[model samples]
Target chain A: MTADPRDLVVRGLTKRYANGALANDRIDLHVHAGEVFGLLGPNGAGKTTLVKQIIGLLKPSAGSITLGREDFVANPDTARALCAYLPQGALPLSSFRLQEVVELVGRIRGGDAPAVRRRVDHLIAALELDEWRDTAGIELSGGTRRLAGFLMAAVWPAALVILDEPTNDVDPLRRRLLWRLIRQLAEDGSSVLLVTHNVLEAEQSVDRLAVIDKGRIVAMGTPSSLKAGDRQSLRLQLSLVPGVDPPAPPPFAHRPIRLGQRWHLGIDQSDAPEAIRWAQDRMAAGVAEEYVLGATTIEDLYIRLIGREDALDRAS
Target chain B: MNLFTRWLRSYGLMVTWELRSLRTVLPLAFVVQTMISSGLILGLGFLMHDITATQAQFLAVGVTVVSMITLGMVMAPQLIASQKQSGAYEYLLSLPVPRTTLIAAGLTVHSLIALPGAAVALLIAWLRYDIALSVSPIVIPAALLTLTTAASIGFALAHAIPNPMVTSLVTNVLIFVILFYAPINFPADRLPVWLASVHQVLPFGHSANLMRAGLTEGLASSVGVSFAVLGGWALASWSVTAWVVGRRA
Candidate 1:
């Protein structure tokens, strides 16, 4: 079967910087139309570099990026026309009012004036930015400015929307609204590529996700599929009393990781009864504050997939 | 939309954006420029015990050239460097508008900001020194070329350098040289022969010569050579700017 014209297909994408740093190794991925695809990675994992290549800000060393029938690598103008990018940095709207910024971007992208204005109004209301509509960009808080930046891109939806760290610095309430807007865009038939390192959010939000490490894609699939390998494993998290050393790991448990006042350990389903008994005895002896045993989360899987020791060290 | 229509629309929007975004700074910029231009005309007169009509004309015309060059060479680069430091440059490049439109809009806005100062200086010279200028039609192209060339060179410098601090330092040094070291307001022959020879090949001396030709008839020698030289510099500088802006990696 032929692919839809709006699908994004990248094959053998590679980028080697002048300093001999391979920012992106040979990579392949496909994002279908109307899908919310996520690229999850830690800092410096080449997520931004890959997005830059797709949007024509950076040239690939060797790659084929096709959107529908068009070659994005060779035709950058088409890439610009077809994709809308919300960069990781703050938007350059210091002098423009929130409403004006969105309308101007839409018009510049060739949206009809009346239509652009309508969409701008809708986005402002939807994003709960009505009170700040006339406020200049510099006067707004960082999170508000970021929301306005999203409006600037969403007011004129392109074939593909690439948002890098869209939820950074956003409050929980507005973040939910932002995610809803992203879903609405996908429902309206645009592909959304979300780049972030927030593992829990990715697990809940994306239709599919790729975990990148050291310029390579370590894994890619639906959330469930990616976590399938850990289905039989249980996670035991203990909140230890202050000034108490972490307890030793049980025989069936994986290495225990101490994160400040808490310790996290993974164990098999058969070891759950013994793990809980051990936690109870420790709490009774005043060595632990509380304990909870649950299924392994994407965060745990992510740590394990990328080498837990190194990932934990970086996290700390 | 057709290509022309799309370009025209994008260009209009970009110009509006630039003007509105800079509305606050522009007023101060205009005031500073007017002060600089008028200050040079009046302040330099103190150096002459008995100024002649020819000397007054040179000073008057030279100050106007200074005003034009300052906006393009000094102000443009500084503004661009600030934008780079603030991450606006990358955001702008990611937009779908034609890259040329951005350059054109910038030049237009900066040129407009420059004009009132040049005019004010000329008026001051007329009122203070009572100097009469020929004011030939060549002044139009001469002024346009001077501004475009200077602004292009500034844009090239700002984009070519990766560090905003370095670009800012370079522009500051450039303004110092243009104001004190270069033969802009003064006749080139007043400098050492070697320096005068160097000015022949540089754009600064040629820029003043073209403006002088426009402001006073017969004041500028080799008008054709000056135009050719200024035009060449404008072309080369603009080419460099376009290349830097268009490069993707």
Candidate 2:
């Protein structure tokens, strides 16, 4: 097979601390260019450690990491020049103003001050951080600190940008803005890696994702593909007649969920037709209005891939 | 673009941050130290009518030198330990900066805290003894050696110790012990010859001796050996601290 030009190849990457804790086990990951790749895992599952190793913050205990074909271990400065990383809740220096923090990070990453200023100005404006641009980092609100971190990561326009938990502590509106920015980065041909605990958020935003558990990748694919390959589960919303109580009659018994004035059930896709048929038959017998069936959501696929228990465990 | 420039940038940023923090804490420390010394000496000097004008001058200079040593031992280690605790050192390590920059920045900031204490002590001496003070050519090298030595020892202690509070307390005790009971605390003649030999070997004793030799008129001839000892301590301490930092990295 031809070597992929637009990808980072991590082969047998392992990191063992001196105390003998293996933060990252032997693992491999491929992130294609122009595709937003989400690294999903629970806290301490090595998501941050793996990302740090990928970005050259920590050397792997054993393995080779290549960024677009360049050996990162041998020349980390050059490799790092090609990527930007926003560590989890990375703080700007307390003494530095928001604009100074962005400009300094941008400059260190090889952008000129004037050019950095323009880009930083645009990012501040885009993120609605202009009002806080001159405020010192210690004085900013938590969400503003997050905005500063996002600006620092994006201000340089590096080829690959890794953001760890970019949405945590951010308000919903700014989270939407951040998601849009990640999409825009990939659209502009820069690979984006998002490491997060928010599976639903990743599902809505990532072009593809890797679900890592206990230092290993358990699943990797487009969100829909991962969800679809699990034999396609369907969710149905059905309204029961006023006097008809819900019946739990089958082993694939309805997983009760609320949708408007009806009760929803998660069922195997193969059984969806029969289940819908049953629902329709009930409706004819005097069931209420509104019966619908739709493709499985990412949350459903995530549950199946990792198993319901594992998913809930990871989520908790 | 070059390693030197990278080193300079990193070292400059750290030094700026260190100096900013030192400024916030140094003034109160300087005032407290000065007041304590002045009060103690005034109460004691009047009781001892045999204290000569020259001895009074020596006493003031001794207080200042002791203050420098105290600040270096107490303030410097606490600064380093606080940076370690605050995650500042880890943050610095994450950058592309060389390790020597961290050491240099820390030393430079601590040495700066010594400057004002030294100046204030001199002013008190000039007022109390009517002594005309000049920047003697020997004082430059001597003061630089003393400051550099004090800073390196501080760095080494800070690097070796994990806890800031414990380090500061231990350093303060060490500073007091070396500066108070040793022959270096007074004229060398006041000590038994055997104990004087022992006092001369202590790092603070050497620092105090060197400071006295640089400031006093009759002791100018002894400044050369004092400079050499001070320089030797500085070099040794820096190497030790650097090794510790390298191992950490």
Candidate 3:
């Protein structure tokens, strides 16, 4: 059966290298039109490889990709025509000025000259890239170059836009602006595949998401849905006073993850009152200085699903 | 658009992009290539006092052939490897243009940039050696074929070989062998029978032979075979390049 032109459908997608390392297993997912779908995963979680396959940069060892009523494997040019990709790092067009790189991609990706100029101007201003507009890509800061690359990826009218870690290396203020632009892109009816491990920000942004780990999707749903999946579970995080022997985390069903002076404990939602009661007892003893009890976050779900927190925690 | 028009547009875009980026360095690149290619001939002129007319002619034409060889065989791999290493290769692939159009445009840009060096070498040789240069109708076509064949071989190797570093070194080795060891600027009889036989099959020797035929009239003992060999080499090089560039790395 054919998929709608407004959707990107991947079925039984697998990428096994000649050395027999399965980078992507028999995975499947879909992103409908006008939705921002995030593929959240830790490093080496097969997110980039899956996107590369979808973009025709790598051939799937098995199964197929259906994008906009065409098989992406059979008709990749058509698939590419309907998509725009912002790869993982900075824009690679070092020979051109920042603005020129944007306009060049616009034209090459099928925009007319006049329209390209106007669109490039709008994106540059919107992204706060005016100061560095005349600078060559080789000379621009990494953050500025990433901003330009993100803007260029959004220039053309591709139904599906793929962004791999769009906010990486960007400063805090620019990162906020970037998230705003992504929401605007979705509002304009582009289906965005945002591949990132920035769970907190992405939790607020994506309409739905899939958590992939070790070539398999361990979890899939909207942030709310995934969080709701474990409605029985809630997170208990406490910031203890410095150098106080942090008590044995009161035996959480799943091990508590420690961050600096804080200990994050997961418990059944029904046990929240008791957990808070226990935390309150510790607070009275001046052990836990501050505390936060809330529903499980996309990050908590991430740490639980991937089962490898230290590396991803530090990276994200 | 038709295939021809589409390719022409792509060629225009690629060439324009190349020239725009290279505006400041184009002059210097051309001058350096010319000097690097012909600098040896100038040294030979200055150093060799008792050189005969045959030796001077050999030196003149040999420098011209070496210029094209260096441009095609050595320069192509180095430049392409640099582009690939810099992530520019993926950047170009992400564009809407077809691979063939890009490759054609790249070859065109490379050949155009490379011509001035060979031309300068020929001019310097013409003046330094007082050699009689021929205005043969076949000269330009033969030169184009020789340059394109050598360059295509280089482009093919750059994509095929797993290690770009080694490919670059090998091109240098090939250049040295052709210049000093092969009978490029010397008599074929001086080389061993086995070495001469090897040159008979390889296009490097035929490239110089064809150029020699165009420069002077009576040296064409096997002109037909030389043309065939160079043309075949060009065709084969392009075929291999198409194969390697089309595959995923």
Candidate 4:
């Protein structure tokens, strides 16, 4: 009945279709106040479904969603009154002029005509949507319209704001501005749920994150927390000559992943003492031309965790 | 604001948004509706050798009934289905407005569209057949009830079957029933007793009967039954639509 105003708690959340395919299984997550919580997953990982349930667009087969003090599923009015959602893909309000979409959301959510106007103007200027202000959503470029959708949700600040794949297809400059804007929204005390597949950007942007795969959270923690176990492992990234095989499996608690043409071998800290020597031997053997040794990062953790799950899935 | 006021605001806002978008295509929509609604009446006039004034008046009103039914039962469902395909349906549903309010606003716009088409048909009847329509206040309420009933059914169908292709097919089938099979253009007694009994319960025959009575004095045999049947359809369809719209995908 009483919960923190700037938080979302999802517990024992499960979604199983009538055909008996489990999309999400007992997923539990706690998004804290004033922090951007990233729900990172590949396609078909139930990230969208979970967000849909949280936004009251989809009903879960089990469990409850609590955003702030209200049960979002049981009391959508309160939940929506206190929260805003930006769905994935381009803006769906393509029929409306850019400014009209902004104003509609502003007025509907905020209910203060003048204040919403001011905020709409401010966000338009900040996100540089002034030029396309009169254009319909379909007329603007992809990034411009996407920014409009984001502004629609952010035009009136709320306790909890949910954005699904907010940065997909956006240019680097606008993505940066958008990230800054998201950070500002959280700093102003909005709990931001950023669901995305861009793991690299999420690793930097999220205060805390969860890695989901095949309908379950494989990993959940801050970027630093996810990397806590990785501290024992050193990342050995190397570009090997074509037609040449990868280096012999290193004697360490390690997992090697191929990213494009390069190979990255994650070696445990105990073996960290030998990873450089090991890389040196491979380099001298002419098996590698370029090599870099660094601390294991969030991407490493994500790959390692999901890699295990995928392997088990194949076996099953 | 109170709950009623909140719902009213949401309904008005939704209609405003939909109408604003519709402004660009209003001319085309008008042409299509006008052609379809009046074409049926005009074709009857041209094809028949010696159609009487009373018969012409009945045909004009029946054709208007056909237009309103097609707009609500055929057009509304297809439009909602298209919205679902374009992802705008989900976006609209996610808004804080009440679900019924959204449907009401949509029904209002579609029903409003039906009127102009009916007007064009009435104009054709006056200019061509010299039939004078009675100024009956009941016509307004009758059209509102009839359109709302049909629109609710269409909305229910849209949510029940969200696929655009399937919905289009279904709406086409419905249009055919309203145009040829239903008693909208003729008295239920003209059909076999079994079919007439079925039409007695259905809202379409009642719809045309109500419209005919409004346009011509003392023509409807049972206005009360017609109003009751149409009201029942409205309530039943509205219930189904509200239930289906909240269902999980």
Order of candidates by lDDT, top first? Answer: 1, 4, 3, 2
lDDT of 1 at A176: 90
Task: Give TM per candidate.
Answer: 0.93, 0.76, 0.89, 0.90
TM-score of 1: 0.93
Q: Comparing 2 and 3 by DockQ, which wins?
A: 3
Off by over 4 Å in 3: A1-3, A89-91, A229-234, A237-247, A252-255, A258-263, A267-295, A310-316, B20-28, B46-49, B217-221
Query: Could you say which candidate leads in DockQ?
Result: 1
Which residue pairs collide in model 3, if any?
A: A232-A269
Clashes of each: 0, 0, 1, 1
Question: Which candidate gets the maximum lDDT versus the true structure?
Answer: 1
Report the C-alpha displacement of residue B39, candidate 1, in angstroms: 3.7
Tens-digit per-residue lDDT, B44-118, candidate 3:
777777888888887887888888777778877876776676665665666666667667776776666777888
True lDDT of residue A130, candidate 4: 83
Model 2 residue A43 lDDT?
A: 70
How far does residue B147 in candidate 2 sit from its true spot (Å)?
3.1
| DockQ, all candidates in order | 0.73, 0.18, 0.38, 0.43
Quality of candidate 1 docking, DockQ: 0.73
TM-score of predicted model 2?
A: 0.76
TM-score of chain B of each: 0.95, 0.87, 0.91, 0.93
- TM-score of predicted structure 4, chain A: 0.87
lDDT of 1 by residue, A1-316 (tens): 2478789999999999988999999989999999999998878889999999999989999989999998999988889889998998867788889999889999887798899999998988888989999998889998898898888778897899999888877778898998999999999989999998888887889999999998999999999999888889899998999988777777778856766787788888999999999999999989999999999878887776675434432111
